[model samples]
Target: MTTYKESGVDIAAGEEAVKKIKNDVKKTFNKNVLLDIGGFGGAFNFPVNEYKKPILVSSVDGVGTKLKIAFLSNVHDTIGQCLVNHCTNDILVLGAKPLFFLDYFATDQLKTDVFQSVVKGLTKACIENDCALIGGETAEMPGFYKKDEYDISGTVVGVLDKKNLLSNRQVQKGDILIGLESTGLHTNGYSLARNVLLNKFKIDDYIEDLGCTVAESLLAIHKSYLQPLLPIINNENLHALSHVTGGGIIANTLRVIDKKNEIFIDWDSWERPPIFKLIQDIGNVPEYDMRESMNLGIGMIMIVDSNNLSFFENHLNSVNQSYKIIGNIK
Candidate 1:
């Protein structure tokens, strides 16, 4: 008898995986989540009364090829955090606070321990961002994925007061750009990074320049800018915000600025993080590709009026957040 397990899909293992993650997933819930995990769809009771005019903002993102590093290093927990944080930062640039998150995790075969670890990371980040993990889907497809490999993607739905909505229309010339430091690559450019670095090094290999193992540097959790910027998002001087992701600085930052104004970046204003440097030198990757592909160092850019430079700088310092005055609008 060719059973489901023999054919590669394990119904039993899937059930076991769900059993392991149930409690941890519940920890991310708030009063807003009206439905449980096994339901057909997640039920969120939107807090329509919170804002005079409440707007729902949502974004979906995955960790990309960075998962290859997780597979190689046998570290799975941080990948979940990276996914949630990346999505959080996406909507955050537009001045939204996450309300709930739903995840899609798919694998060839479900391993209970790995499943548990991934959910634990997810719940941890959801709690940290004051978001609820109301529901998620775990698919076990035996032939679809390679051995021991899985892919994760998440959708974050958030709320913003219509009065506080931010956009390029608010940006103007002479806006100074303040760049916030990144933890690492932060879920981008891994395709180029791996193609270049892996030829010369293994995941566990420690490099002096990176000051850590290859996996350690690459798997650094994508930082969430919500905490620091949330308190000051509506400030008059803070004209616009940009989350630097797949397209690097120019592509991402430009999206949040006025078309009439052009951004001028002082490349030398800040030091390039070491991991980026290693990738460039080792891969002989061109300067243009580096700038277009990776964050290099800065992960978020704040466009604000020059008059309030001191105010912004002092505020960041108070929070112990490092920043660089990288450029201005022309």
Candidate 2:
């Protein structure tokens, strides 16, 4: 008779991993989370009476190839934050506030400490955004994943009043495009980035241009615009929002605009961040590829009525948020 452990599934280790992370995960709960970890299902109370017409907006996303940087750098913590924040921004573009989040973590071997660190990152972001980490699944499969490597994906659920739902219909001609600066290459373009950078430089190599090591630049946490944009999200002058992710600035911004209207982006509006320039010069990457793949410095785009330009600019300035008038809807 073959034991489960003999088959490479250590039930005891799995139990131990859950025990370590139990308390950390609980920190993200508010009054709404009904059940805790290790349950058949996590239950969250929906505050139905909070809105006149509540709309449930949900998005599921993974960290993508950016995880490769985490694996190479031996940093497991920030990757979880990347997944949570990425999902938060996805629903945020629709003008929703996160209610709860669920994560899926899978690995070939169970490393209790690494697992705990990842959950800590998740709980940190969830707490920051007032989102609950209701539940998640952790799997240990011996032959499935590569050695000492894991993958994570998360699903975020948020709510918005129907009246606050932002759509392309709200975007109009003469709408000004305001771009929020990105921290770095936030959770996208790693396939090309790694190919170019890693070939010529070690992960820890310091470059004067970047002012940091390759690991530092590549593993920068993805920014969550929730707190910064929440104040003006419902304003009448704020027409639409685009979260720059897998698609670069142009494609992602175009996603939230009307098909009948086209966006004019001044490519020279903002200087490309150093990490991007390094990738281009070393690899001799074409400008079109750079524009198509990376955020190229701008992370979030807001299309606001030109008449209210001063209002939007003032609000952002008051909050100490930097922005650029990259273009307008034509």
Candidate 3:
């Protein structure tokens, strides 16, 4: 008789992983969490009384080829955090407060240490965002992944008061575009980054421009915009937000913009990070392609009323966060 273990799925290890992560996951829970791990479905106590009208916003995302960097560096922990933060930022742009998160991890061989690290990262992000790690799945399929390699994806659910939703409907011709700085690549453009660094230039030959090893430059963690933008969510003139991701600044920003208004981005307004410059120099990538494929140092863009530009600028300055008036809606 054939058994499940023969097909490469390790039920035992999965159970062990659940046991291992339970404490770590529980640490992120608050009054809202209703169910613990190892259930058919996870549950949360919705605080419906807290808002006049509450809308639940959700987003799911992975780390993309940034996973390849984690695999290469044998650094599995931060990718999970990156995945959670990336998803959190997506809904934060919509003025949502994250409620809970669920993760999906698949691998051929589930190394206990690596798996724990991944869960720990997820736990950390959930705690930081004031969200609970409700539940998740860990699939061990020997043939689905190469040895020591795994993939991660996460789902985040958040709540927003109906009146507070930043739907981009308020975006108009006079709105000012404020560009928020990114730590580095922040989980996009990695496939192109790897091709440029590994395929074009040898790591041993450090380029004078980047000032770091290619691997170090490529493995920068995808940052969360939560702390920086959360305090400003209630500003009446804040029209919309765009999280710069796979489609880059233009396409992503356009998703939240109306067709009648055109967004004019001043490319020269912000300083391009040296790492991006190095990638461009090595690959000779086209300007349009670069703009479309990468964040180009601006990870998140906030659209605000032109009249409140100075107020927003002063607020951002008080936080000691660098920003620039990248452009305007026309």
Write candidate 1's Cα lDDT for 1-330 as tens digits: 789889988887887788789899999988988988877799999888778988899999999999999999989999999989999999988889999999999999888888888888899999989999988899989889999999999999998888888863378788899999999899999999999999999999999988899999999999988888888888878999989998999999988876787999999999999999999999999999999999989999999889999999998998888899999999
Clashing pairs in 2: none
Q: Estimate the TM-score of every prediction.
A: 0.98, 0.98, 0.95
The superposed Cα distance between candidate 2 and the true structure at residue 59, in angstroms, equals 0.2
Q: Which segments of candidate 1 are over 4 A away from where they belong? A: none
Q: Write the per-residue lDDT of candidate 3 for residues 225-318, one digit (tens) a residue.
A: 8887888897879999999999999899998989888989999999999999988987999999899999999999999999889888988888
Candidate 3, backbone clash total? 0
lDDT of 2: 0.91
What TM value does model 1 have? 0.98
Q: After superposition, which runs of candidate 2 have C-alpha atoms over 4 Å from their true positions?
A: none
The CA lDDT of each predicted structure is 0.91, 0.91, 0.87
Model 1 / residue 173 / CA error / Å:
0.5
lDDT of 2 at 33: 95
